[model samples]
Target chain A: MDSHSHPAPTADVATVAARWSKKAVVVAGVGAVLAVVGGLSAAKDGGFGKQFGFSYLQAFMFFLSLCLGGLFLTVVHHLFDAAWSVPVRRLNEHLACLAPVMFVLFIPILILAKQIYPWMQIADPASDAALHAKSPLFTPGGWYGVSILLFVLWTFVSFQLRRNSLNQDKDGAAIHTQNMRVHAAYGIFIFALGLTFAAILWMKGLEHQWFSTMYGVYYFAGSVWTTLATLYVISLALKKAGPLALVMQRNQFHDIAKLFYAFTVFYAYIHFSQYFIIWNGGMPEETFYYVQREQGSWWGIGMLIVFGHFLIPFLAFARIDAKLNIAVAIPVCVWAWMMHYCDMSFNVMPILRPKGFELTITDLGCWLFIGGVVAIAWLRSLASHPVYPLKDPRLGEALGIHFHDEGDAGHAPAKASK
Target chain B: MADSNIDYTVKLGLLAEYATPAELMQAAEKFREAGYRRWDVYSPFPIHGMDDAMGLGNSKVGWFTFCCGASGYTLGMIMIWWMNAHDYAIGVGGKPLFSPIFSFPVAYECTILLGAFGSLGGMFILNKLPRHYNPLFKVERFSRATHDGFFLFVETSDPKYSDIETRKLLESTGTRQIEEVRD
Candidate 1:
């Protein structure tokens, strides 16, 4: 077996990150100020407050996708005992760690819940059929209770996974691996249920009357799809930037791209099914959601999603070689971010600016502010630790090393015999 | 006993035996660099990186799958449209006679079905499969290819093949045995 050398110290990555952190702080400040200005102006008639509420909710959901995507990736890595992703696992852990930050971020939405969610304002639940049927969950107490519980469950699972992982970096013990498996065993359930519930409460709740059993998975598929693109760009940067050069291999990028390709189809599959089922069922209650989205520019945005989100990436990365080409991959990654923002806007903006898709200062501010905060938090977490798990048992496997066992001692070592 | 019925007249190729997969891989790289086109390596089990060692690139089987799958979807949509709207004009539930929405489930399944057929057919075609004869079948030692043996065979038809030169190249890779196969 070939032994890979230990990764060098992360001083170089840390230096670059320090510069980025400063820039991120500036961006975050600018975004916050802009969002505040937009909010105050709109508050004259509560137009901007409602706008601010919906815009922030959209941006919040977008970032939440990344955090949940991170947790999902980390949980599965342990569950499958995957080797190829071992190099990128620490990045995933730090991303998942942002769940607590997301909980803090959720405070704004909690305050604006009434402004954002109309169902909360209805005097009597009995007056509204859809609202009444959904009863306890539709109630403000149930909404806030379940919302807090989701964050708690997510933060717990994300921290447990990361704690075991970081401890493994210290001791390289099999026990850490075992402990993670125990967490992941239950973590998968938490992830599925928690993500579904959050999507229902926060985004889907905007239209409390809407009904789609596939809504949770629809959000999940898109979230992970965007997350994979983000991971690809980050891992590639780290590889070129020197922290992950030794451990990262060609196959890692290829595999990541391949998974991204699969999710492109998967996201399309899920969203299409959601639409197809409702369209076929032809129920006015459910069909109203699509009917509203089909009006005006929301129609164009929907078309953009079908082509830009699914078709373009699906075709662009279809070739095996294209997945490894940084030229092709970087552009697709950027496009994926744009597409996901559009998707989030399509879901959230339809309620506030039902005429069409409008890009407001609040929208941009909320996006930039939340994105910068997450980036700063993620960079701080990344710089503080070893860029990759230093002592992972499967690190060698990820580096493409093949070890022959003691049973093969009788065979002549190839190079020596040659 | 069955093999005794045939006569060996034509020379088929040159074969070299390696003790292990690592040696086979090394020899494969040498042959690849030597620019021999009609050669292959055989081992008891699949070897990773062997394709690159032998200078092979991505397979072309994907084209077959894509084209066939696309056609299957197109054909499926057309089949539904012709049967329901163009031919009979039956009204069911007052839905559009041929919206891609209603036809999609069937079309998607057709894409998968024909895509699988394309994969199987492409593999068989590219491999030139259902082949009934090979001179290597008569080489007793080559039978170990299914067990512990690792072998390399360079066909005489290769543009680069030369009895002396090929033998010297195989020898340089540290193969212990080399034999000339005959048909």
Candidate 2:
């Protein structure tokens, strides 16, 4: 094996983090103002409180997806003991740390739960057996309690995982790597539960009459795609700053892009699979959801998602070069984010604004509100240690990787003696 | 051409062996930039950047797959409509004879089936696989390509290929061995 490249020395982690923390503060400040503005207007506009409730849910879910997906990626990084992603793993760790902030964010949804969830407002369970059957878990109290538990679970595990990683930055002990890997292996199971339960409880619970086991996976797929797209932008920004440009290689981008592509197809596969099965059953209850979506202006948005969310980005990022090329990748990432926002809106907004489409001030405010808080927390957490793991055993492996299969021969060692 | 083909079992190409994939990759870049076509690189594993260096473009199979899927979907739609409206004229619980929502399931399946086959068939035809014979297989050392070897084969047919010039280029690239392959 070739012992070729090693990571270049870098400025202190404290210094590099200051650059991002300022941006985080600004984003948080803006988010705080938006939350206040959106909150006050919703209170005053009593007629549109229901819309605000759902819009808030939509924005909240979108931001939650990013953090949940970040946790999932961190687990995968450790589970596979991935070497290529070491430089960027800190970004994921910080996002995963946003689990606490997400916990606090859930309170808003609880306050708006009665308006958003149909089952919560049901007069009597005796009249509705389906709602009654799932009442043990989906009850308002049960829903809030179990969801809080899920977030608590997520925050605890995410915090522990980040601590283990930060500790490794201090000491390159195999034990630290080993402990985190084991923790990740099991943490994934808990994270899956959190994601699955959160998806079913919060988003799917919007229409209690409608149920699909694949709903959780749909949320998961969205999380992974959005998480990766966000990471790509962060990595691009870091590289542009001239620090990570020397330490990190383009190979990481290509690898992450490959993963982004897989999740994109996985999301479509899950989306289509649920739709295909439900449509084939031809049952009135399940089919009604599709009918509702396909009939109105929602139909237009649905078609847009099919093309924008899946087709265009799928085709654009299909190539190896496209994933590795920063210019092409950024536009595709932005498009995917737009489509992700559209996907969440399609899920949430149809309950109120089914007429066609409308982007209210509250919707814009809520999005900025959730995004700003998480951005602030995740960015501040970056300074916990070095931008890259200072003592990671696989740092060399990351530094030496070739981004593409046909990478320049100049990068490889003198020759393969084998 | 016939006389030439009849002589000496037919001259296939010049087969050059490089000690490592890196060397073969370098030779590939040199030949590609020198504008030689009708040549290929073989190694135990793929070398990064070989496709771009060889001036290869994206595969056209995606287009084939797309065409097949679109046609399959259209065909499914027509079948469902014709059977319900004309041939059988059966009522699906009084639903419209051509309800597109109900037809989506079958249309989706058909699209996937035909698209998958299109890609498989397109790849096989484009690559000319299941080929019965190639003169390069006559070389005993070539078999190591699957295990541990790197090869760059420049066909005699390439316009840039000349025995003396090609031989010198391969030697300059530090090829471990070079030989003329017979058909």
Candidate 3:
């Protein structure tokens, strides 16, 4: 029997690190130039400056949500002892490292909360009226503090676990496995709590008075959808760059593609269900959110997502050929990323523009700035280690398996050795 | 070793080949009833409950899927709360921050998303899919079983298996051809 062992060459790691660093520098430079241009333009229009700041806050929160979601996926994979994700788990873990960066990035939102959130402008008595009339559930300070604590805790735990796993590679100790299992068990609990608080602070609070029990799940669906799409793009880029060329195969890509499809559908279902239920109930306050989203420019974006996010991708990925074919999968992955941005934009813009609003230089700038920072953080993490988990026990198992057969019968049956 | 047409025939050793799907299923049931543990059934198409007929326990996949679905729901709810209630606290149309009606879509989506993930991930883990190489694949004739044949093999590792006795037992069961499986 073959030992099924293989090592990732050091030259491969260096090449990957160098390529990612170059890409990071280029993206950062472009984003910096755009931010200055957008800031100057906003300065020319006084009211637009305020909108720029608010949009920046919205973008920051969206990025933070993506990091938190990545953390949740990593911990869940650990808890389940998942093998299929072995090829890409490192990328997800590295993305989680951005949580600390997000913590700092979120400061902009915290400073300008009053300007963006209406609840900040109303005094205690007026707030009390709003709260009383609304549902005595308003607690801005408590909500803020809990969100900070959750981000801190998740960042701390995820970094520690990932660090330990990488260290295990050098030490080759059985104790690392034991430690990981323990971390995984507790990590899942924190993930649940942290993600819940994250959704409340980010999306649900967009409309302080408008409450949705399903808001967290809705945000979660978007999070997973975006994160999975992001992972697919990153993995594809890495493969093209040639460092992870050997480790990632068509089978791994197939797995990631499947996840992207599943979550895309999941996100659409939640989006529609929220609308359907609110429209059916006919409540003025709850239904108004949808009314804003379904009309004007926002309406057009929603329609785009309906067909672009769900319908288009659903048809494209329905067949086994498309899911496994990079030619087809890459475009769908890019579309998923675009739809995620549109979805987040639709959620954020409608809250600020009661009378409806137009897209500004700031909206695009905010996305670029935060996206630039996220790209930088991800690159820095990737540079710090090999693109693949060089010492993971399952690396060999993943390499040896072939998930699909050449013909239309799909998965082939296992053969018995003579 | 001598030329008794059956002796030199190479005791394929307890290998039982079935001409029809029903016969294969019946042999599986009998082996299961006889308390045989280390045996497997092969067919041209998936034989439903062959695992159970062989007395295998229910798969652990359900537990994994349930956990994933439950967590997905919980995660969805929390995400909505964090975004709407905690972070910005903006009031859109005077709706409460924790409205169940609004949050249901996200929660439901998470459940389905996680459930599907659990099913796919669980199937891979339980059945050990994507395995390109297995000891069983070394059997030349075994390759055709997946194409258009039915077979049942009681591994020599089984406690009840013996060269002579097992062969006689398989002969009694009306197998026309038998083949030895070596590890």
Candidate 4:
């Protein structure tokens, strides 16, 4: 596989990264201006501080999905010893590395925690039975401590994975592969615990009175679904840009698209199961969450999640060829971003804007700001490393080239062109 | 060995054997370009990309699965609505007599059950698969298809098939074995 020489890609990585970095700064600045203006405009309605708090939290959770999703992908790659994902593993690593950036961006949420979480603001927690029952985990100290711990765990896992991968590129060492497997073995447990806690504390904690055990996996299903869409587009762009053209084949795109398709059904299954159980039991505590969502335009947003998020993607990509068609894939990926945004809003925005679903300028500003930061960080990570693992053993398998070492006469020496 | 009867001398096709799956795939591609419709490649195991090499299109079984699955869902919903809401009205938990939400689990199950039935039945119908016999079965070497052989067969019925030309094509593909099958 390494014997074939590739023509350099038309696009330069450093120049592209530099250009995008400058644009990201501008985007963040512009986002700040828009957020301030939106906040001031809504001063009389719910106070500027409150509006900023809700908008920031919504944007925070939305972007966090990509990070958590990236972490899941990276961990699973090692766990399954997957060959098809070897080419895209580097991209996912950079995505997971954004955990530190997310940790820094989380400052605003920490600052506005009291404003964002009603449980924190309640004067007498002992008065409310729900708050009193869950007093240990929902307390301010517990919340902040757990939040910081989740970030620390994510950064350590992702950075270690990337470090071993980069080292392998320098010297084609099998030990790095074994090391990554170890990290993934322990990292998966951390991921499940950390993700569940983050969802429970950050989003589900908004409704302190409501009860639902399925909330964590529900958020998880949507996160990975959105992440797969983002990965599809990224892999496509990088392949066209030249760096990944050699390693990426139709096999990569087809497999990624198929995984995305599976997640679509998985997300629908999880969301519907949660709804069905709640709707069937008709418990006051569980029903209250859906009841609040049924009000005003929230009802329409819920319907959108059902149809737009589930049905459209399901039916559109039902054909076998649709997964491989670029025209069909790009549109579906873009639509996934929109649906995931609506999903995030459906989860976080209902408490703040109880009347209905509305897209505020503050929301857009926050989304742009966080997205810009993440893009710059990801691009820097991309520029600093070889676009793909240069010497990973599976690289040969991924490219459809089989290697026969010395003394391995048990296998045929035939060359099969794929 | 005195069974050389002229009455049974009907040419069914030509069978050509290649040493490996790679060569077989290359030959399949050539046969596709030659526009030979009634032909196929046989191997002990499936070769990836062989479908493309053979110029085969997507199977039509999906239509059967989709249509049957849709009917299964619709019928399930209607059956529940008729039985519970109309024929025998029984109130359970003061819920509506019929709701898609409550009935969804059953309907979804029906969809899977019928969808599976459709696929199995569709495959049988499309492949004409309760096959009793074929002229190829008479070729002793052809039985190796279930073992280690990689063979390509082009029927005499195919428009592009000429015994002389097809034999030459197989020779060009680097195969040493060729034989005719009688129906």
Q: Chain B alone, model 2: TM-score?
A: 0.91
Docking class of 2: acceptable
Candidate 4 interface RMSD value = 7.4
Q: Could you give candidate 3's per-residue lDDT for residues A297-341 as a string of tens digits?
A: 788887887888788987788665578677887888778777777
Give candidate 4 misplaced runs (Cα > 4 Å).
A3-11, A402-418, B1-4
Q: Model 4 chain B: which ten-residue window has the lowest total lDDT?
A: B1-10
lDDT of each: 0.88, 0.79, 0.71, 0.86
TM values, all candidates = 0.95, 0.84, 0.67, 0.95
Writing each residue's lDDT as its tens digit, candidate 4 over A222-287 gives 999999999999888887766776777777887888888999999999999999999999898899
Write candidate 2's Cα lDDT for B42-114 as tens digits.
8888766566556676788877788888888998888888888789888766567777767877887898989
lDDT of 1 by residue, A221-289 (tens): 999999999999998888877887776777788888999999999999999999999989888988999
Kindly give the stretch of ten consecutive residues in candidate 1 chain B with the minimal lDDT sum: B47-56
Best by DockQ: 1
**Error at B73, model 3, angstroms:** 26
- Candidate 2 error regions (>4 Å): A1-24, A42-44, A47-52, A80-87, A111-130, A170-174, A247-250, A276-296, A324-327, A352-356, A389-418, B1-13, B33-35, B44-57, B83-86
Clashing pairs in 1: none
